[model samples]
Target: MQFSADTMFPGDLFEAATRFAADTLAAGDRANAWQQAVAMGWPALLVDEARGGAGGTLADLGAVIEGCARHPVGLPLVRRCAQAPALLMAAGSAGADDTLRALCAGQVDLDVVDAPALTVTALADGGVRLDGVLEGVDAALPFTHVLVSAGALLLLVPQDALPAPTARFVGIDGAQIADRVLSGLLLPASAVLQRGEAASSAAAIAQDLAIFATTLDMAATLGATIEQCIAYLSTRVQFGVALATFQVLRHKVVEMYVDYESASVLLARLVADTVVTGRLAARDVALCKLYLNELARRGAEASIQLHGGMGLTAELPAGRLARRLLCAGFAQGDRLTQLARLATEPTAARL
Candidate 1:
């Protein structure tokens, strides 16, 4: 069945989020963003109502994401509202209740493990040892706990158990990122959040949810960028006429808008499928990511090329928007990695 975005997500939530993000999306004001998110009850959108949350649906979450896309904030809203909640629900661990409450209250922030760099060793006494470096992690927020998956086991490691991050700096997208160095960090049996098949399943689903949220956010931001470009072109005069009057420039802006529209349709379908099936198809999610990456690159170039020198400066919103579009690919796996994954999929899935 075809999905209509208007029918799926609530209008009021999107409007409210748009209003909130407009005033608070500026960089270096993470505390204000967090406070506003809490006030809006965004962090609890996915947690069950009984668990002191809003008991909202995925569509509700999408509404807020769409609104925030007007100006993307650097908060961990995707992880907090989508990934962690999915992980906790899939694990069915009562012990996660306090963590959920803390998250709802904005008392703690959580980050996902990068998975590849870390080495995990299981102890006979039900403990685990971790040793390795997590490179270029966006743990700049006061992340109090980390969600980690070691093979078929999932563990929640407290921030105190690991050393402080190094080489910290604000990224182009205004995220405070650093490299986390882990040396023989050990956690007791109680740290295990899930094990066996449950852990593996939980980790996969959580990541899928996160990808869904992220793709929607990126697409919305691209749409906003397209709007900004149109506004600038219509007003900026050149060669005795507006830039929008130039056929070449008008065509480029149209192309960007078309790409943004395509992404919006794909996101709508993905959201509909998830709400109905309660799961995301990995292949579809990867396809969305790859498509958005390509779209972002194209949009970024067209935006910068059209804006000329102004696009190169940080003082303008066009430049900042383009930077974010380009950076989205690097946040998870780059285009090359995603291409390889698709290349390795089964023949039927590929078809």
Candidate 2:
């Protein structure tokens, strides 16, 4: 069966994003993809209208994400548009207004890093020194700024203040990642985006929202990948008959469909809860993250297996979609990390 995200977003907006992704992202032009997405006001999707943004809801953002993911577009909409805007809203500071405007206008790109590896030292001059290595930060090339989460404090550092990434790699979906070594980098009090009890609380909420948003994007990608598998099975012939005609292969397709639909139902409820109540139950979000990760893994492997050797080749969408699904599973927090977090929750103590 064909999967469409028309119900999630306005028809015009969804179509526009799909067309753009197909035309631009098909060539792997993420830089141009970023610019075009900006021109379309995508970065402002989650920002408030009062703050020079469209003030759209998280579900609305999901629609755009789904549209792009239909072509398996790998732009960092979740990080830049959804998470960054939420962070700025939660940690508004003296220069945050200009930062938000620039971000929404696509004049700048930003990524949030939760660096447990970093050692933060408070200096007598009301500054802090940072030293450590930041691992697996999902950022675009030439990241103009980075929002560093060091313990209870959040620091916004410009690109020039830090050296080049110690290592760079590409994610399965074609986004850029960096591993940076921070050695005695100093930040004045002014660089602190937020701190203390209130800041810590806001940062946690922002992180939860980002994780939930990533799950939503993963669901979209998985759905599209399933559709890709179905299309492939229905067309390519072997032994003088279409693969879809085979009972075993058809059952595999059915299994994938069931997984996608089941996840969709759960995601629908969580998204609605978040929209109505303005937050998700932490336990529910964690559970959903793990479920979707496994679902993506299953779908990717199945798609690959069904396509045989060709599925592993980049020339086909199967490979790209599989890569994206596998990689996205690790975003926000990997399976092991999330599980450990759940183990520490108050509710988990009952078990």
Instruction: For candidate 1, give the lDDT of residue 332.
Output: 60
TM-score, every prediction: 0.89, 0.91
List the candidate 1 regions with Cα displacement exceeding 4 Å.
1-10, 26-28, 105-107, 344-351
lDDT of 2 by residue, 1-351 (tens): 344422344467667777888887557777777777777788788888887888887677777887788776677777777777777777766556677888877777787777856898999987899999977676564468887777788778877887667898876667777888989998887777777765676576677777888887788777888878888888899999989899999999889888887887778767776677765666777888888989989988998999999988888887888888898899888899789868865442110
Q: For candidate 1, which ten residues in a row score worst on lDDT?
A: 1-10
Worst lDDT 10-window in candidate 2? 1-10
Question: Each prediction's Cα lDDT score?
Answer: 0.75, 0.77
The sequence of per-residue lDDT tens digits that candidate 1 reaches over residues 7-118 is 2244899888877777775554777677667767887888888888888888889888878767756566776677877777777776566677777777766676646547
Clash counts for the predictions, in order: 0, 1
Q: Tell me model 1's lDDT, rounded to 2 decimals.
A: 0.75
State the local distance difference test value for candidate 2: 0.77
